[model samples]
Target: MSAPEPAKKPNAAPPVTRPVFLARATYRQRRMRDAAALLPILGALLFALPLLWLGQNGGEARTSHVMIYVFAVWAGLVMLSAVITRILGIGAAPQSASDDAGAADTRRG
Candidate 1:
């Protein structure tokens, strides 16, 4: 005959669950996020400009100059975007449930 299974503990606590909150962006936050999303595209366009100009002109010295400018501009744009996001506090924490409930109460009244 198979062995009997061990008895379960009756004092075990159930798993505790907290509410999950999502961060909803405001209009300005949305706009800033959109701008951040576009940074790479803008950087690519900026990088291409000098390359295109140098490709048409075809000078060894000009080619080097344009390459340097491209790198410098690309780096500058990355830094600028970092600064903008930092100043805007783009990743601020979401409001807590209590805070949200309080705001809703104030609005309804």
Candidate 2:
């Protein structure tokens, strides 16, 4: 027969376990931050897309079309940034006077 397992002490606390998932708000904030981080890369790729068009049709891509595309991409990126910032509550909090004073003190030191 197999030996019996040792019993846990009666007074010992149960082992703590981490939560399986983040809270809804925390998960959303993290996702927003991730989107914010990826925004620049997405913009870079979008801007580079026009270059690919330049090589197509024997370099016949129209300058006006490219300009329009560039502007549209720029506007889209700005809007996306604004949305992410708003969702993440970036700069939403009012700055306290003490915070400014701390900065000033740091600069003087």
TM-scores of all models?
Answer: 0.48, 0.70
Q: Please provide, for model 1 over 1-109, each residue's C-alpha lDDT reduced to its tens digit, 9 standing for 90 to 100.
A: 9999999889989899865843555656777878888888988898778645634456443767887897899789979898768867878767899999999999999
How well does model 2 score by local distance difference test? Answer: 0.92
**Per-residue alpha-carbon lDDT of candidate 2 for residues 17-90, written as tens digits (9 for 90 to 100):** 99999999999999999999999999999999988785456876989899999999999999999999998889
- How close to the true structure is residue 83 of candidate 1, measured as C-alpha lDDT? 74
Give Cα-based local distance difference scores for all models: 0.78, 0.92
Stretches of candidate 1 off by over 4 Å are: 1-25, 54-61, 88-109
Q: Could you tell me which residue pairs clash in candidate 1?
A: none
Candidate 1: how many backbone clashes?
0
Best by lDDT: 2
